[model samples]
Target: MGYYAKELEALLRAGRFRRPIMADPEKLDMASNDYLGLAYKRKLLRRAFERVAAYPWHAPKSSLFLGGYHPIHRDFEEALKEANGFAAATLFGSGFLANLGLIEALVRRGDTLFIDESYHASGMVATKLVRGEVVLFAHNDPRDLLEKLADHPTKGRRILAVEGVYSMEGDRLKREFFEIAEWFDMVMVVDEAHSNGVLGPNLLGVFDHYGITPAPRHIKMGTLGKAYGSYGAYVMGSEETIAFLNNRAKSQIYATAPSLLDVALAHEGFDYVAKKRKKLRKKIAKLQKCGVSCGYPEPEGLIVPVPMPGIEEAVACREALAREGFEVGAIRPPTVARPMLRVILRTPLEARHYRELFAHISEWRDGV
Candidate 1:
């Protein structure tokens, strides 16, 4: 207790210890990534239960890529393509591996990589592996990328990586940046982890909302864990790119594949959200009506990261919220230093629920 006391005390003092609130089916939920309430949907659960029950005793004997490939796995990939209308896609056990594997597989020795300054932590780690020149551009500013690419030599494959919709900011990528990647003849790779089932009317993802389809060199990565209400991720790209990743990506080649049950559960979730996203939009509007300002802005996406000026204040705020039964966490350095507090919005976050949460928030004087 003594050894852990300092960390725990600090978090409590600052208001950052996120109480793992047990989901009270009876209580109105305002905090979660289940944007469309797909996880709780009876239809998806029935499918998931059936699949899991089918394999009651044990998992499949072999890896899906080798001799272990199952019909369900192929079906999941097909469902993903059908949902997003991409040329091809391949699933990963999780988003971390998908982002890390894709970047390391594409960017090589002589290439240059330009990434958004506020990109995900996985991207930052992926940069360390590639023996290429890594340059940081101001977040979401195409102008910086334009200047950097113009100044840079027409070297080996240049790739511009960014989040399709920023996780913390809850903001969508500006359309102007697409032309920047095209002008430089760079590969445009975007991580759509946070937007898979929360952005568009049906959560068809970023492209669906913006109507910007990917060209040959463009690629999009998404996760089923966050808003999709399941586990695993996928990278959507050209057929050649998908093949290259399948054959060349070490993470894919060496790692064990996702469980059959996991894939089935994920597919059920995707299908559930596809049918329910439009109705969920009204719930999102109700959340904003409660005076809980989105960190970025409204009607953009589901994330609502509040930029707390200071770490202590951000930490304190999370603590205060949790004490009142709101399980919000204070996002700080390493996660999102720019925005100290990230407000993640999902469906079922009603106006009255936020009012109750805010009422508790108003009681706090200052954060730790």
Candidate 2:
């Protein structure tokens, strides 16, 4: 304890000390990543439970390589591949693990990984474990990416990573990124955690939204926790790429298979999204309108970030909203470059609630 005391004190002084608090179900949720509100739907839960109960093994007892790959997992993978127009798909314990496994397994020595600077931290951390060269381009700037590519040439494969709807800024990936990847012959990895089930005509994710036919080099990784409202993740790519990951990705080979219940629930979530996409899109558009009316830029997705002056002010604003029976995320340094209130415009929240939230945010921004 004494050895870590100084570091702890420093964090406290910076107003970045962290602790998890119990979620109050009674409060109106405006912070969590359950974009489609599938987490609160009892019908989905009931269906998932029924499905799980019918299976002989409700839990994965071993790694997927060791016979833990159940029919449920395979079915979900198949569904994902079909919906997203990928040749194959594989499941992972979570989005972080998927990203970690992908970067670690795909980028070998002599290879180069050109990633967006604003990509998720998990992918950033994975770079340290790989033997490849990494180059970061300006966030969402394709010109910077092209410049970096011109500056660095590699003998081996080139991989590009970007997010569909960045978590912090809530901005969609630029269309030019896909074109660049194709022109440069790079393997493009799109993290669709925030966009899947929330965007596109089919709500399959960014690929669907952009109407881009996935090439052999295109890879898509998406989480079930956000819009899907479950847990676990899936990666979709060409059949050969997925097979290579199965053989080389230690994270998937060493860890136990994902929970059967979660996968089943996510499958139900996929169906739910398909059935309700039209209504969900309308809800999202309404929230985006409200945000724009309140002086915020129109959100590319469901996340609406309200910037705060500083860390202390961000915390204070969160507490004030909590007192008013609203629960929102007060994001600070390390997670975001600046302090902000992350408001998730979840579909479960009514239009009136959004209006109220925007009003409060406008007041706070104006120092009313």
Candidate 3:
């Protein structure tokens, strides 16, 4: 216990420990995943309040199999399934739970899981729990994946897992990579947590964004929080796949089901996203332009990575911007391979904010 305390003190002194922050209304937030600003939108808040005022104000007391499942849960799943073109969908307490349960249940001791090295922490941890051969391929590299698959002499089921939009890098999986997975007869699991409500014509996620249809063996996992401005997660697949999860997935089977309030909020959030899609696209376009103007990579989506080179530089950049009444995330080791400043775009920003941000960056860079 004394050694643990000493290690924690060292981490805190080294600026590695994370701390929670209160929402500052005056500061411009460039760090959050509220891409469309729907999380703080007046409409969604009013809707949530209305739902809470109605019924089930308390937490669902049990897991889905016991007494937690409700009509709203089914309705939410059905709507997501239809929207994403999946035959069935099942809800989870969170994106972490969905990834954990789905991957752990599907892969067995004899199976092989070819996971992208840059997959989310949840999926990474889940792969470790699976009693199988887990091979991590280079991030978004089809050639690397193909070579790895060729080298492995496994006659068991091969599973390929990737993210539709990688959270830290803000890059997406290429179509060629998907083609490689198909050629190898691997079960494809795409986590679209970051792209679900922010991409595609109908906001169905990466499949729709790339104009590709999900195959029968493909499983899609996504969250309701980021772009939907709600909570919980869901997995979309064929009816048989979902049925298997209902009985086999320990995460969903043992955890308390998402409450009525969450279901109502998510349903309302989906509708809100549908209505605001056009305006949100315009915001992304504007943000992309801002990134270019600020001498950063042309942002292809809501997430933008501003290079700061080293850990010290990245921390300095975050602090510099914060001093100017702007709050942006500082990315460091573990979360990413290298240090960089992470910026997330939202809907309410204007051209002047971008110009000012760039000015601050220039000043900070020159030590003004």
Q: Which candidate's TM-score is highest?
A: 2
| Model 2 per-residue lDDT tens digits across residues 2-104 | 9899999999999999999668998899999998888989999999999999987799899998989998999999988997889999999999999999999
lDDT of 1 by residue, 1-368 (tens): 79899999987775456555476565445556666666776777678768767753436455557756666678888888777777888878788888889888888889999999989888888888987888899898988878888787756998999887887776788877778778778899988886676566666767776777778788989887777667788888889999999986777777777767777888888776767667665676666455444122453676656557676776667666765667664676556655365555556555566556655554563322
What would you estimate as the lDDT of candidate 3? 0.82
TM-score of the candidate numbered 1?
A: 0.86
Going through the candidates in the order shown, the clash numbers are 4, 0, 0
Error of 2 at 315 (Å): 0.5
Worst 10 residues of 2 by lDDT: 287-296
Clashing residue pairs, candidate 3?
none
The superposed Cα distance between candidate 1 and the true structure at residue 9, in angstroms, equals: 12
In angstroms, the error of model 2 at 231 is 0.3
lDDT of 3 by residue, 46-88 (tens): 7866865666545667899997887778888888888778899
Winner of 1 and 2 under TM-score: 2
| Model 1 CA lDDT for position 192 | 82
Local distance difference test, each candidate: 0.73, 0.91, 0.82
Quick one: RMSD of model 2?
1.1
Candidate closest to the true structure, highest lDDT: 2
